[model samples]
Target: MVGAEESGRLVTVGRRFEVVRNRPLLTLAVGHMTVDMYAGLLPMMYPLLAGKFALDLKTVGMVALAYGAGSSLSQPLFGWLADRHGTRYIGLALSWTAITFALLGFVPNFAVLVALAALSGIGSGAYHPMGALNASAVISEARRNSAMSIYTTGGTLGIATGPLIGVLTLGAFGLHGTIFMLIPGLLIAVVLLFEMRAIALRPRRTGGSPRLVPPPVPIGPISVVVGVMMLRAWSVFGLQAFIPIWYASMGYEPSFYGLLATTLVLANVIGAIGAGHLADRFGRRILIVGSTILSVPALLLFAQFPGSIAFVTAAAIGLLAASTTPLLLVTAQQLMVGRAGMASGLVLGLGFVMGAIGVPILGAVGDAHGIQNAMRLLALIAAASASVAAFLPSEELVRQFANRNSNALPAASLPTASS
Candidate 1:
C-alpha cells in the first residue's frame, strides 16, 4: 500500500545505512589477520624447538598445553570484559600479543619458553572477542555474514601464509630470526589504533552497564547453535591434528603436508568469502544446513580416497566445513542481541577450545582403532551436526529481531545478521 516515491526513498535510506555501517569492518579484519598470524608461528617453530631442546613427545605437548591453556580457556572471560567495559583497547592488546610472541626466540630455557607462549596466548585471547564485537557493531544486520566472512577470511589467509613466512625467516636467520616478524604486528597494531580512534569520533548511542544477570531470552536456540559449533570444531581439529601424520604414514615428504594444508586452508578462505556473500541473499540457515550436509560426504570422500582425489575432497571438506563458522557466529550474536562480545567469545573462543580437546581424543581413537576408523567417526559427527542444524530458531523469531524497534535501539541492541 505504500506509494512508489516513498518506497524509493526507503530503499535509498537503506543503502546509505548499509554503506556507513559496513565501512569500519574492513579495518578490523586486517587486525584479525595480524593477530592470527602469531598463532601460526608456534606450529611452524615446533619442530625447531623440539630438536633444539631434545624434547620428548610429552615435553613438546606440554609446551602446546601451556599455549592452549591461556588462549583457549580465557576467551570467555575476556569476552565478558569487552562487553561489560569497551573494546577501545583492542589495538593495545594486539601490540601486547606482538611483543610476547616475538620474544619466542630469545627465551633462555624451556620454562621461559612455555611462559612466553602462555603470555602470547593470553594476548591472542584478548584480541578476538573485542575484534568480533567491533566488527558486528559496525555492520548492519543484513550484511553481518558478508562482513564477518571477510573478517574470518583474513585470519584464515594469515594462518595459511604464516608457515611460509616462518620458514623464510628462520631459514635465513636461524631461531633468533623471529625478531623480524614483530614489525608487521606492530605496524598493524598502529593502524588499528588509528582506525578505532576514528570510529570513536563518530556519534553513537551507548549501551547499558555490564551485569551479572543472565540474558532474558530463550536459551534453547542459542544452546543448539553452540552445540553445532562444538561438533563442527571436533571434526575440524581432528583433521588438523592427523592429516600430516596420515600423509607421513603414506611416505609423502614433510613439505607435502604443508602443501596440502595450505590448499585446504586457502579453499576455506574462498568458501568463507563466497558463502558469506551468498548467505546475505539466500538466508543463513539454508546455507549453513546445506554446507554442513554436503561436508559429511566430502570428508568421507577425502578419507576413503587417496592421492589427488584426496586433495580434491580435502578442499571440498574445508570449503563446506570452514564456511559455516562465520555464519554460526552471526547466528549466536543474533540470538543474544546485546551481548555481541559474549556471543563472539562463546562461538569463536569456545569453539577453539573444543577443537583443541578433540585432537587428543581423536588421536587416541586413531591409535586404538586405526586412523581410517577415526575419520569415519568424524564423518558421523558432521552428519550429526547437519542434523542438529535443522532446529534453529523459527523464521518468525528471526523477523521480529530484525524488523521490530530497529532504529530505536542502541548499537549493541541491534539484531545481528543471520536469523
Candidate 2:
C-alpha cells in the first residue's frame, strides 16, 4: 500500500507506512487476547484434568511440555515459509490454529488430548511469525525498538489475561467449557488474515525489483544476539512456571497467588512499553542492561519473602523480564534483514523451547534441593543475558542489514493501499 504519488516535481510516499504499522497492532491484540485468555487459566486446568484422567504431576507436566514441543518444532519451518512465501502464508496457519485448537476442546481421551495440545502448539507457532513480521514491516529503522515494544506488549496483555479467563470460565462453565472462550478469539485472528492478504507485499512494490528468493541467513552479530536471547529464555520460563507454586508454598493463598500472577503480567505490560520507548530514545544495550540488573534484585527479594512485599518484588521481576522480550524481538528483526520470519522464530521459538526445558530442570533442582536454591541460577542467567546484550554489535548489525537489503520501509512500517 506504500504507493508514492508524483507531483510535477516532488514524490510523496502514501500513508502505507501507518497502515502497515497499525494494522498488525490491531491483529496482534486480537491474537494475543485469545492466547492470553488461554494462558491465564492454563495453570488451573492441570489439576482438574489430572483428576479426570487419574494422572500424576509428571504426566501432566508432559502435556504442557508437548504443547511447547509442538510450538518449538514448527518455528523453523513456518519461519522459512513466511520468509519464502511472505506474510500470506499466515492465512493457512491462522485457520489451521483456530480449527485445531477448537477441535482440541472436544477430545477427552488422554492420548488424544496430548495430540491436540501439540496441534494447538503448532497453530500457536504460526501466529508468532506473522505478528513479528507485521511489526517489522511498520517500524522504521530508527523506531524498531518502539514498534517491537508495542507489539510485544499485546502478547504480554494476552498472557496476563489468559489465566483470568480460565479461572472465571472455570466457575461459569467448568474446565471443559473454557474452550469456548478461545474459539472466538481464534476465529477473529483467522478473519484478520484476510486483511493482511489484501495488503500486497511492501518490499515488492517499493519501486525496486523484487527478489523472489530470500538470501542465505546472515551469520554474525545476529547469531550472537539470538544466542543470548535463548539463554535468557531459560530463566524467564523457569520463573514463569514455578513462581506461583513457590508463592503458594510460602503461605500465600490461592486467590492471592492468582492475583499476583495477573499483577506480574500487568507489570510486564507496562515494562514492555516503557522499555520499547527507552530503547528507541536511548539504545537497546542500555535498555537490556538496565532491565536485567533491576530484575536480579526483584527476583531475589521475591524469593526471599512472602506476602505483599514478595508479590511486589515478583511484579518488578515481571516488569524487567517481560520488557526484555520486545527489545530482543526488535533487535533480532533488525539484525536479520530479509529474514524477519526466520528471525522471529529463532528468537521466540528457541528462547521459549529453552524455557520449556528449563521448567523441568528447575523442578528437578527444587525437588532435590529447594525452589529458592534453584532460582539463584535464574538470577545469574539474567545477569549474563544482560551482560551479553551490552556487547552485541547492534549499530554495526543494523548497518550490515541495510547493506544487504533494499533501503525502503517494509510492509510492517507502511500504510495500506487504501490509505
Candidate 3:
C-alpha cells in the first residue's frame, strides 16, 4: 500500500509526463491554425477590397506586400529573442494579432487597412518561431518530421478554411464580418497561455546550461534550401493572390472562385501530412526534388485549364508544390542544431518575403500581360526551384554536418593545448 506522500508524488509525475504528451502539441496546432487563418482571409478579401476602393490589381497587391513585409521581415528578431529568452509572450502575440486583424474591416481608408494588416502580421511574426520552437521541443527527435507535419497541417487547414469563412461572412455582411474572425483567435490564445504556464511549471530534468551562442550553420546547403523555398514561395503566393481575380475576370462568382481557392489550400494539408511521413521513410531531398519537378507540369496544366478542370489542376499544384513546406522547414532546423528558432526564422521569413515581393510582380504581370500568362510564369519558377532542390545535402550528410558543428567551439573560444 502506498502512503499519502507517495500517492502525491505519483500524481505529480503523471502530470509532468503529460506535459510532454499530445495535449501541448494540440494546443500549439490550434494556435497555429488561428493565426494562419488571417493570412488566408487576405487573398479572399482582395476582391471585396478592390470593389470598395476602386483599386487596380497592383494596388490590391500592396496589401499583401505590407502584411508579408511585416510578418516575414520581423521573424528573425522574434526568433532571436525566443532563443535567448523563453517564449513567454506567445499568447500575448496571438491576442494582439486577433485584435488588430479584427479592426481591418472597420478601417476608414485603404491606407488604414494596409496599416492594420501590417500590425496584425507583426503579431503573427512573433507567434511563428515561438510556436515552432515549442512544437519541436515537445516531441522526440525520431518523430519530429511527423510532428512538424501535424503542426504545419494545422496552419494549412486554417488557410484552407479561411476562404470559406471569408466568402460566407463577407458575402452576407460585407466588411463588418471580419469582426467575427477574432473569436477563434482569442479562444485559442487563452488555451495556449494556459498550456504554456502548465509546461513551465513542470520540473526540468536537465540542469545543464544552454549555450549562449550556437555553432555556425552550413552556408552552402542552407543557401540551396533557401533558394528552393524562395522560388516555390513565388509560385504558391502568386497562385493564392491571383487565382480569385483571374477567375473573376473570367466571369465566375465569388462562391465558385472562393471554393476553388479553398480546395487548392486543402490539398496542401493532405500533401504536407503525407510528405512528412514519406520523408521519414524515403528521404527529404528526394521528396523535395520530386515534388517541385512534378509541380512544373501541374502548374502548367492549371494555367492551361479553367472551370471544373481547373479545380483538379489546382489540387495537383497544391499537392506537388506546397507539400515541400514541412520538409524544407525540417531540413533547415536540422542544419542548425541549437539555433532552431533562428533557422526557422530564416527559412520561413526569407521564403515569405520572397512570396510577398512576388505578389506585386505577379500583379504587374497580370496587368501588363494577362493572369494566365503570369501563372505560366509560375510554372517556370517551379522548375527553377526543382533545380535548386537537387543540390540539397542528404539526411545523412546533414546530420553529420550539424553534429560536428554543434560539438566544435569557435577558434577564439577553444582551449589552448598548453592549458
Highest lDDT model number: 3
Q: How do the residues 353-379 of candidate 1 rate in per-residue lDDT, one tens digit apiece?
A: 776666656666766777777777889
Q: What lDDT tens digits, residue by residue, belong to model 2 across residues 1-419?
A: 23333452242222223323566565755665555444455555665576678855446556666676677667767776766556654555555655665554467698998887788778777777766777666546566676777777777887777656655665566666655755666576667667766542333444555544444555776676777777777876676666556665677555676677778788888888777767766777766767777777777777677678766887788778765677777777666666777888888888777766666677777766787877777887777777777667766566667566544445443223221
- What is the lDDT ranking, best to worst? 3, 1, 2
Off by over 4 Å in 2: 1-21, 53-58, 89-95, 98-109, 200-216, 247-253, 404-419
Task: Please report, in order, the local distance difference test score of every candidate based on alpha carbons.
Answer: 0.73, 0.66, 0.82
Model 2: lDDT to the true structure: 0.66
Q: Cα lDDT of model 1 overall?
A: 0.73
- What TM value does model 2 have? 0.83
Each candidate's TM vs. the true structure?
Answer: 0.82, 0.83, 0.89
lDDT of candidate 3 over 1-419, digit per residue (tens): 56988999997676434423677677778888889999888887888889889988888899998888888898888877766566765888889888998888888899998999889989888888777777777766666777788788888888888888999888998988999988988998888787787542121222365444557878999999889888898899889999889999899998899999999999998888788777767878888888999999999999988899989999988787655767888788878766777777888888888999999898988889988899899999988998898898988998897678657634333211110
Superposition-based RMSD of candidate 1 using all C-alpha atoms, in angstroms: 4.9
Model 3 stretches astray by more than 4 angstroms: 1-21, 200-211, 408-419
